[model samples]
Target: MTTARDTILARLGSPDGDPAAEHAALRRDYLHEHHPDVDLVELFAERLADYQAVVHLVPEGELPRALSRALWEGGYVIPDGVPEEWVSGIEPSRRAGADTDLTAVAGVITGCAAAIAETGTIVLDHGPGQGRRALTLVPDHHLVVVTADRISADVPGALALLDATRPLTFVSGPSATSDIELSRVEGVHGPRTLEVFLT
Candidate 1:
């Protein structure tokens, strides 16, 4: 009556072989990232842009101007933890609850935990400057501000920087999918536009 999974468990639980010993027998090291010779910032930007997302590299103090120019349409909203100075010229409507109507806002700007150079993925642990999951999902546009030093070399490095206990959202680009007939549809499930500012 024992299933294959049960048999495997029995062997794994045997006195001779502990899980740690089994793990020790396997190769534990591999290349973490490729082309380490290249600049990490450039790699991260290229990966991010490859996903159909626009990546902006701005000067240290120019985030406010860059954000304003990118979010020129106005009506932008932000999470509570987002710094007020980031949106200097625009009035940002605040949203505290998860059910807020995000589509009404022209864009939603937040901060990311880490950016992956290999995958062009941005990780959000719903931490400070990052609101609930709905904030990024419901809004038509997502504008994320990240620092250049926050870029990780690869997915594993990014994973190491994240807190698994928190809600994590990995966004590579705007929400999009191709239909069966080969037509591409955007914003079907999440934000249609993704903007990243690497300062």
Candidate 2:
């Protein structure tokens, strides 16, 4: 019995009969980063802002105050693995976990594994401080904390720093999509508002 998947696979069989070798033989000539001379932090900020995210450049010493002020409304969740000092003075409404009630929180605060400046994308590996997939997706707002050192010049540069085995989430901007009529909608798949604090 030929299943639908089997039929599809049979029709799309490897053309060269050696996909691995064929891929390895392909020419590869590409720049890893386009603007080597540009400051990654500034470039990342610019690109992030272009994506309609509220970007804040805060000093390390002032991050607590900034975080407190930004999350003053008090309905945010904090995930595990966030540095103690980072949220030392602020209190989150919920602590993210498997049983966390996503509907109760207005937003979530998290840390990213790496950020790509050229693409204005934040990559999350669901590591400590970064919660499970639902924590960021279900909330209406997401406040991401990014350090200057974590900023990469391009996607390749960022990919080099990430572990391939971990589940990864690449957030370019707030959830948005346009239909056939060209009507744009925001917050359709993820947070409607994205705010980033860069230190």
Candidate 3:
């Protein structure tokens, strides 16, 4: 009665693995935040920009207007659960699905679960405003909305807020890679452009 999961675990050399025991074995003394005095939101924006992602700081109650200006062209995909006010005036938005034509859209807009300052990563749990994997991956551009409260000082703090059982997408700027010749290229695996509007 060996299950597929059990077989996979066996292959990985942890057939009888105890989740609690494994977690306890890991070191917990590591410093969670490298710069305690630095503001998490500021640090996050800095790191994201360093990765070549465009970062915008939006004032409170102005997210809707900012979103409209960014995706003004209007062929973008809007996943379910995104706030109505966010996309209210933005017309011609496509609903994402398996049949979505990635080529036809300008990009995808979604909200993030948590943002890590140290790594400048946006972690999405594919819940609510955050869409499924394909909605974000197949598009050429990705525009995310990150709130100030969602910004974490470090990865450890960010992970504490996420659900491990849910599907997670950790985005650090746009998708890119370097070949053996040291030439860099963008848009290989995900969106070529990542624009973040921090509110």
Candidate 4:
């Protein structure tokens, strides 16, 4: 049976090409940083927007009000460890975490361990305020709160803030995919809406 690699090898007239050597060559050393002087929070907001996420940047003291206004429609629940005051006006009845069934919940709010500006990704290590992976995933909407100090300038910087052995969940955007015909669909595997509050 002719595989894609075999077909490429045949076209290159190198049927004896070594796959292992090709793999090694592709694993070359790479850059670990970029734009050291650029504003990471700004970059993070821009990248997050690019992924179709609604990002809000608010001053530290204004978080509660900002959070209340964003979720005023009342369709979200806060995960464990998410400071009570952050979702104060949103109604405590909605908050739930740790082994809760989130499938029917409109959204779940939680804090993140670190955020990567370069990739616009939020990493959750199930830390204090961040709940289990399922808490953020099963719900159709995710409201994430990120502190300024948690936003890293690059992937390398973000990695440096994480513990290697912990269970890590990196969310780039609302779960979405395109079919073979190029039609796009969302919420196929995770939340279809991601609202981020970057403090």
Best by TM-score: 3
lDDT, candidate 3, 1-199, per-residue tens: 9999988776555747877877777779989889899988889999999999999999857887787787635377778888887777566534445356877777899999999999999999999988788888988889998989999998899999899899999999999999999899999999999999998
Q: Across residues 108-176, which tens digit of lDDT does each residue of candidate 4 receive?
A: 788999999999999999978887777887888788999889988888789889997899999998899
lDDT of 4: 0.82
Clashes of each: 0, 1, 0, 0
Question: Clashing residue pairs, candidate 3?
Answer: none
Per-residue C-alpha lDDT of model 2 across residues 1-199, encoded as one tens digit per residue: 8899988876556675677776576666888889899999999999998899999999988888887787634367788888878877675333444466887777888999999999999999999989888898998989999998889999889998899899999998888899999998999999999999999
User: Predictions ranked by TM-score, top down?
Assistant: 3, 1, 2, 4
Question: Where does model 1 exceed 4 Å of error?
Answer: 1-7, 10-27, 72-74, 92-100
After best superposition, candidate 2 residue 109: deviation in angstroms?
0.6
Total backbone clashes of model 4? 0
Estimate the TM-score for candidate 1: 0.83
Which residue segments of model 2 deviate by more than 4 Å?
1-28, 72-74, 92-98
Candidate 1 residue-wise lDDT, 11-119, digit = tens? 5676677667786676749888776788888888888888899889988678888887787454666787888777674543433234456666666889988888888
> Model 3 — TM-score against the truth?
0.83
Candidate 3: lDDT of 57? 93
* Pairs clashing within candidate 4: none
Worst 10 residues of 2 by lDDT: 91-100
